[model samples]
Target: MIQRLLFAGLLSGLVVALFAFSFARVYAEPTIERAISLEEGGAHKHAAVEKGTISRSTQRNAGLFTGVAAYCTALGGFLAIGMAFLHGRLSVRPRSAVWTLALTGYVALVLVPQLKYPASPPGVGSAETIGVRTELYFVMILASAVCMAASVWIAFRIRRRMGMALSLAIATGLLVALAAVLMTIMPAVSETPRDFPRGLLFEFRLHAALMQLIVWGGLGFLFGRVAEHVVEHDRPAGVVRHRIPNA
Candidate 1:
């Protein structure tokens, strides 16, 4: 039983880690380019970056690392609570799909642009990128939200837990959002307010990270539980399940 639990924990952590690396790479790819500039042709194979640029990268990397880090951190959390898989009531393909859509859109459409330029073009970069770009991103955000709602609803139907899955997932999201909003908006009491523009940018990334953490953590916990229950109850106890399609 210990071995099984460890295996499950490791697998879940891997899921979270891979998603984190992939998602961060997607969003930070372009920005990483300019942050670490090509060096003068002094024969250094690697490029050099300014102290300011490196500082910026460090901040971005911290947020990106934390976004996926939640998954790994949640391991002992879910396990100790015995609902790491949300009692298996939250696990389902639909649930996973919803998370996938949201994460992908966030990394690709919402977060990536900020790496190269700014999320709100009017606010950060040149005026040339302001108009339709914002609208397109808003549309993508809406689509992602819709997918989350519909998928969680469907996952609820698959479990016999009387809508527990939906409630928990939604609750997790709301709690995270509330905390993030406050963190992003509340004015710091520090007297040094003028020096925080760059800090604000990285802090805002937490908004994106918070969402991913809630959704993916919930999915991993829920999926693990449901998968176990299905195998034990739906299939013959002694028979191993196969993934290939049947005739």
Candidate 2:
């Protein structure tokens, strides 16, 4: 099962990386170039960047591929573990589980934090605050995941009493309210310049979100199909029994 899931994840990650590389190359890369231009005294003379050892060609080509692959590979591995855990826990069908997880992961990890800290064009944030910003972003992701897990737990706990529909509705509402409150309390990072082109910023962020949507959506649908195949061929009774390999 682990082997199968690993194979599926790698395959899905590869496909996602291709799409991501294209999206970045077509939409995000130009914005980045503009940011680099700004840093080189086009718009923001004070924000000049020190030259790095890595060549631009490498950054645009090999670097992008490597980064996207590594990221999607890790995400695929995580999703595999999640699928294993969720195998028998929910009443959802195996395919539905994949779709559910895909949507949930995207919402919890990307959308929620993005609302609090939207993606910025290049040269928007400070070099000194990079560490701080990265930390905050991860913290928000962790919080969002925790909130989602809590919501799921709450729904399951109250299902026997409140019924599935009501329990889920209540839990969903609670999670939304909790996330909203967190977003409000978290310190805002406004790094984009006041004079920055609003249309360009919107385009950049829109493409960023679209790229994420493609990755997660592809993973969910692809993995779900693969998992369904595994269940049919590998399992003895054609049932999802949560059998972990060598556990």
The model with the greatest lDDT is 2
Whole-model alpha-carbon lDDT for candidate 2: 0.81
Q: How accurate is candidate 1 locally (lDDT)?
A: 0.44
Tens-digit lDDT track for model 1 on 1-247?
Answer: 3344445545555556666666555664444443233222222232232345446466557755665666554542344234334333333342353344335434433343333233310023323433455554455445444544554554445434545556557644653454344334432222212322454445445544554565455445554554354335545667854432211
Poorest lDDT segment (10 consecutive residues) of candidate 2 = 238-247
Per residue, candidate 2 scores C-alpha lDDT tens digits across 1-247 of: 7678767877777878888888888878888787677667657543437789999889988998899888887787777777777766676666787788888889899999999988886767777788899999999999999999899888878888888779879998998998998898888988776666678788889888998988898888878888778646776875646533211
* Model 1 lDDT, residue 74, Cα: 57
Model 2, which residues run further than 4 Å from truth? 237-247
TM-score of each: 0.33, 0.90
